[model samples]
Structures are given as structure tokens and as C-alpha cells.
Target: MLTLAAGASAPSVATQLVGSGLIGLREGLETGIVVMILVAFLVKSDRRDALKWVWLGVAAAVAMVAIIFVAIHFGTSTVTGLAAELISGLASLVAVVIVTAMILWMRKAAASISGHLRAGLSKALAVGPFAVASMAFFAVGREGVETALLLVGYAENTAGSIWPLVGLLLGIAVAAALTVALYFGAVRINFAAFFRYTGVFLVVVAAGILAYGVRALQIAGWLPGGSNLAFDVSAHFDTSTWYGTVLQGIFNFRPDPTVLQVVAWAVYLVVVLTLFLRPLPAKPGPERAPLPEPSNIPAS
Candidate 1:
């Protein structure tokens, strides 16, 4: 086990399991929903011939994401010491930015996404098989790339433990089952509420990651104030304990955080939370089509 400064223990294998699971669930569902939409559209519009192409695109996207994930997760293993720390810090920061944009964009786009997707698919059909496949590839690929990057960031926090990967796979499995259920009209969900709640959870997670990133940079000597203590509750709160593991795993909480970490965490949480929770500008309800959109999936 790698010894951290000031009596802070290295994270255990299970430390980040829950956080990774949630990320997988959210990202997997988004990817699944895109596939469901495209498939349903093709089926309903009598474009069954294009179904194979759509599947091809989805398969390609998944394969691409897997390759990217493997390359990234293992690539950093080659580096040691400060270089690794610097990479981890930068990667975590990038994940935070991407996840933040995803959260905010989903808030606005969720309402209109179905119509836009259908429209895009329609145009792609006119273009030919390659376009149709490319459309699905890009649509799902975006979510896949985001998921890969986020998972890597989470894994870095846990010192490359296998538990984070296990948690993510479990979450994706659940998401897949849920997506299948919804696709077959066996379940109904208020997607708006779902996204909103998950978005909030992710924002908190991202804030934690951002703080972790700042600490990493500081450790790597890329930033000053590594020893500038904001507060050290190491005596009172042991990170190796069960509760401590949970806190560190879920929120990246450190008993001895630097001034910069605390400031980054606080500012990000307050600003992003406020923006996320604020009422959105009024707009017409999303357009409807013959096939039910994700928001309108039927239960029973």
C-alpha cells in the first residue's frame, strides 16, 4: 500500500465502488437510450433494412470505447511518481469539465433531443447506409468517450484497484437491463426527474474529483502550497476506517486538504449547484412523434 503524507492511508479497493457504479449507470443509460431511440425509429418508419446498419454502428462505438478505456486505464501505469501524479490531476480536471458540460447540456437538450435525433436519422437515411451508420456511431460514441474518461478518473483515485471497474460493470449491467425494460415498454420513468437527480449527484462527485485533482497537481510539484494546510483532522478522522473509506471513495474527501483544494471544491459546488438547480427558461413542450420517446415510455 502506498503511504500518503500525514497519516492518510491509501484508498482501498472498495473505496470508489459506489461512485463508479453511479457513473456507469448514468452514462450507460444515456448510451442505451440513444440506441433505443434509433432502433425504434427505424422499426416504426419501415426502415427495417437500416436496422443492421444501426447495430453495426453501435457495436463499433462500443468497441471503440472499450479500446479507448483500456488504453487510457493502462497507459498511465507505465509512468511513475510525479509524472503519474501530473497525468492523474490533469485527467481528473478534464473529466470534471466534460461531466459538467454533459450535465448542463442534458438539462437543456433532454426535452428536445428525441425530435432532433429523429430528424437527424431521417436525413441520414437519405444520405445512405454509411451516413446512417455514422450517425449512430457519433451519437453513441460521444457518450462512450465521456464514460471512458470519467471511469479512468475515478480509477486513478483508487490506485488502479479492480473494485472500481467491477462497480462500473455492475452499474452498466443494471443500466442495460433497465434500458431493455424501457425499450419493450415494460417500465416507465420520469426521465426529466431522473436526469435532474442524477445530474445533481454527479455535480457533487465532480466537485470532489476537482479537489482531488488540485491535490494531485500540488503533490506533483506543478502547483505550490503542498504543505500549506487548510485543516488536518487526521487525528480525529482516520481515512483507513470504514466511514473514512466511504467518504474518500464517494467525495474524494481528505482529512488534510490544502487551501487550494478546499477553495476549488467549495466554489465549484456552490456555483454549479446554483446553476443546475435554477429554473430553466420557459419553452414549448418537446415535439411528439408516432413512436414513444424516452420520456413517454409506457409502464405495464
Candidate 2:
């Protein structure tokens, strides 16, 4: 049983795969849809010549993400003791922030995403091939970086387990297939609902990461009251078992969390999730013109 402290139970391997898979699916789908929209726009516009440039930008983004992932993986491997703990701890916190922002941004911006891409494509086509490639690079690169950051964050806790990596790769593969179908008009998706539900999932996951960050800080001696037990249910939900690991990876469930950690998790979920799920205010309808006043002395 892995432990942060003397008796803390680490998440089981199964939990790692499931959590990473979800992240991969969600992030991959978001990025895929963006590419799908852009490609479709190009095809419909009969600008097939520029397709190579688009791919060029995508290739660049993918290369950059891969490089960063390897760098972090190798870079952290050499660090030992408190230094490792502090860096990983800081990474988890940053992941929480990035995931939260991406969720909220997707929620609000999804509606106009297609339109925005179409506009961007039109602008880029006029500017020349380099601009088209640059746009693709920036758009795809943003999502790629976000995905990589979150993965690095999760990678820290699992320690040498590759299931998370496998799960994510599978998700991206599936996403690519779906994007192709979407672009070819082979499928139709209710994107609004899709994002809304996935946004909810991400929010919950980010909450777990948030709590993980808190615990990591405590472990690194960055937070106070490490020994204070908010509650302990190790006997009830032992992490060595599959069920316990499920809770561990999915919720960052701590049997003996400090009071501050508990409070932070609760507040984040309540406030962030509440705001996220809240129905957007309806757009006011156009006002109808008032009827013209009847003429007093009129047409004979």
C-alpha cells in the first residue's frame, strides 16, 4: 500500500487507468471537434490546397506536446526527497487551475466555436498559407498543452504505472475517429449538451485534483496541521482494495484529511460546480413593433 504518511493508502492501479481515460476522452474530444470544424470549413470552401498547411500546424503542436511530456517525465525522475514532493505538489495545484479554466471556457465558448473557426479560416486564407498554419498551430496547441499539463499532474501520484498513459492514448484514438465521422457528416452531435455534461464531470474531477493539491502541499510542509485528522475511515475503506482505490483516484479521498483541506474541497465544489451548472440566463427576444394608431379621420 502506498502512503504519503505512515498510514495513508495510495490509489490502486485500476483507479489510475479509469481517471486518466476520462481525462483523455474529454480533452481529446474537445480538441478533435475544433479540428473537425476547421477542416470541414476548408473543404466546403473549396480550399483543399491549404489542407497541408493545416496539418503542418497540427504536426507542430503534437511534436511540442510530446517533447514537453518527455521532458517533465525525465526531469522529475532524477529529483529526490522534498524537492520532488514540492514540484509535484505545485504541478497538481496548477493542473487544478488549468482544468477549471478550460471547463469554464468550453462551457461559454462552445456555442460560437464553429463560427469563430470559420471566421478565423476566412481571415487566414486571405493572409496566406503561413497564417493558416499558424492559426491551426495556436488553436490545436492550446488544447494540447492543456491536456499535457493535466496528465503530468496525474502522473506524479501514480509513480511508474503506465495505465494512465495507456488510457489516455486510447481516448485520443477514439476521439480522432469520432472527429472524422463528424467532419464527413456521418454523425451529428448535440454539442451543447455534450459539453455541459462533460463540463460537469471535469468540475468534479478538478475538485478531486484540488484536494490532492491541498494534501500535496501538506506533505511538502507547505500547509499547516498535517497531523490533524478531519476524519478517518481507513478501516471502512482500505485503499489496498479495488473499491478503495476507486474512491482514492476518483475523489482523492483522504481517510484523514486536515480540516483546511476538507474546507477547501467543499468550497471549491460548491462554488465552482454551482456556477458551472447554473443555467445561462435566457437571451431576451426581439421586441415586436407596436401596432400603428388607428387614423381618426381616414380613408373613404
Candidate 3:
């Protein structure tokens, strides 16, 4: 059973895989789409010479993300007990904040992001190859770093298993394939609908992480009410069972949770879900010019 306390058994690979894979797919697709726009713009504009620099930027961003992920994952592994919980709790909270912001910002920015990227790339082309690469680096790097943070947060629930990492890679691979198909016009996706659905899923995941963070903090003595149990179903639920692991792995569900943790989870889920699923206000269209009035003698 995985609890806020240390030395719990790792979750089942299947459970970790699903959670990590979804995160990978969501973040990967966004990053890939951004890269696709930049690449497509370059190709259409006959700036193929700048392609190498874009690739270079992409490579750099990938490397940066890898380094960050490794550092956090390993760095935290070195600590034990309270220190580990504290670090993991803080990371989880940060991940939730960043991910929530990403989902919200993307909902509004999706329409204009392509144009923005193209414009920036155009400006970069005018500047130099280094600028072009830097543009790609920074643009892709933002998403990459966000992905790393999220994975690290999710990894806390994995109990040091590597299967989640494998799932993340698989998701990225699928996203890359999808992006390539999209670029070639071999596939059609209503990106608006796609992100909207995925955004809801991510919000739910973030709520889970938020609750986990709360519990971790409580255990670490950063928060009160560690002993104030909302309920204890551990005996009945049997977290070692497959079903139990699935719930715990994906949602960070505890058979027994502190009152604060349950409160945090419920509030976060309800408030965020409502805000996310609410209908977006219609975008105002460009105003049409008023027609020239009454030209009775104009023909003459």
C-alpha cells in the first residue's frame, strides 16, 4: 500500500503507465505542433537553410529537459523520510500550478499560437541563424521543462519504478508520429476539440497531484492534521490488489486520507473542472465598415 509515509511498495506498472502516458501525450503533442508550425513556415517560405538551426534548437531543448528530469529524480532519491516527502510535496504543488496554467493559457492561445510562432520565426530569420535556433529553443524548452516537472511529480507515486518512464517515451513517440501525419495532411484533427478534451483530463490529474501534495506535506509536518483521518478503508480496499493499485497510482487515492487532503482534492477538482469545462466566450469578429449611404446621384 502506498501511503504518505515512506517505504510503501511501488504501484503496478499498468497504473503508472497510464498516468505518465497521458501526460506525455498531452505535452508532447503541444510541443510537436509548435515545432511543426515552425518547420512548415520555414519550408513554405523557402527558408529551408534555417531548418538545421531549428533542429539544433530542438536537440538542445530535449537535452535540457533530460538533464532537469534526471537531476530532480535522482536528487530526491538521495533523501529519505521527511526530507523526501517535503521535496516531493513541494514539487507536486509546483507541477500542479504550472500544469494548470498551461491548460488555461493554451485554451485561449491555441488560435493565435501558430501565428505567433511563425511571426517570431520570421523575425528570427531576419536576425540570424543563432536567433532562429534560440527562438525554437526557448519556445520548445518551455513545454519541455513543464513536461519534466510534471513527470517528476507523477514519479513520486511510482515508488521508483522505471515503467512510467517507458510509458512517457511511448507517448512521445506516438505524438511525433501524429505530428508528422498532420504535417503531411495525411490526418485531420480538430485541434480545438482535442485540446479541450485533454484539458479536462489534465485538470483531473492535477487535482490528484494536489491532494497527494497535501498529504505529503501533512506527513512531513509542514501541515497540521496528519492524524485526522477522513476515513480508513485500507483494510477493506486492500491497496496491494490490482484494483487498489490502479486507483492509488492514477489518482493518488489513499484508503485513508487526512481531512485536509480530501478537502483539497474535492475543492480543486470542482473549482478547476467548472472553470475548464465552462463554455468559452465567443471571439469577437472584426467590425465591418458601414456601407456608404444613399448614393442616388452617384451613377450619374
Residue range 139-211, candidate 1, lDDT tens digits: 9998888888877776666654667777788889989998999988788767777788988988998898899
Q: How much is the lDDT of residue 14 in candidate 1?
A: 57
- In candidate 3, what residue range of length 10 has the lowest lDDT sum? 291-300
Q: Compute the lDDT of residue 272 as modeled in candidate 1.
A: 96
lDDT of all predictions: 0.81, 0.74, 0.80
Ranking by TM-score: 1, 3, 2
Give the count of colliding residue pairs in each prediction: 0, 0, 0
- Predicted structure with the largest TM-score when compared to the true one: 1
**lDDT for residue 7 in candidate 3, whole number 0-100:** 43
Encode model 2's per-residue lDDT on 194-266: one tens digit a residue.
Answer: 6778778777777777777787778789988777878987678767887777877666776877887888889
CA error at residue 230 for candidate 3, angstroms: 1.1
The candidate scoring highest on lDDT is 1
lDDT at residue 1 of model 1 (Cα atoms):
11
Cα lDDT for residue 291, model 1?
Answer: 28
- Per-residue C-alpha lDDT of model 3 across residues 15-74, encoded as one tens digit per residue: 677878888898898999888888878877888999999999999999999998888887
Cα RMSD to the true fold for all candidates: 4.2, 9.6, 8.3
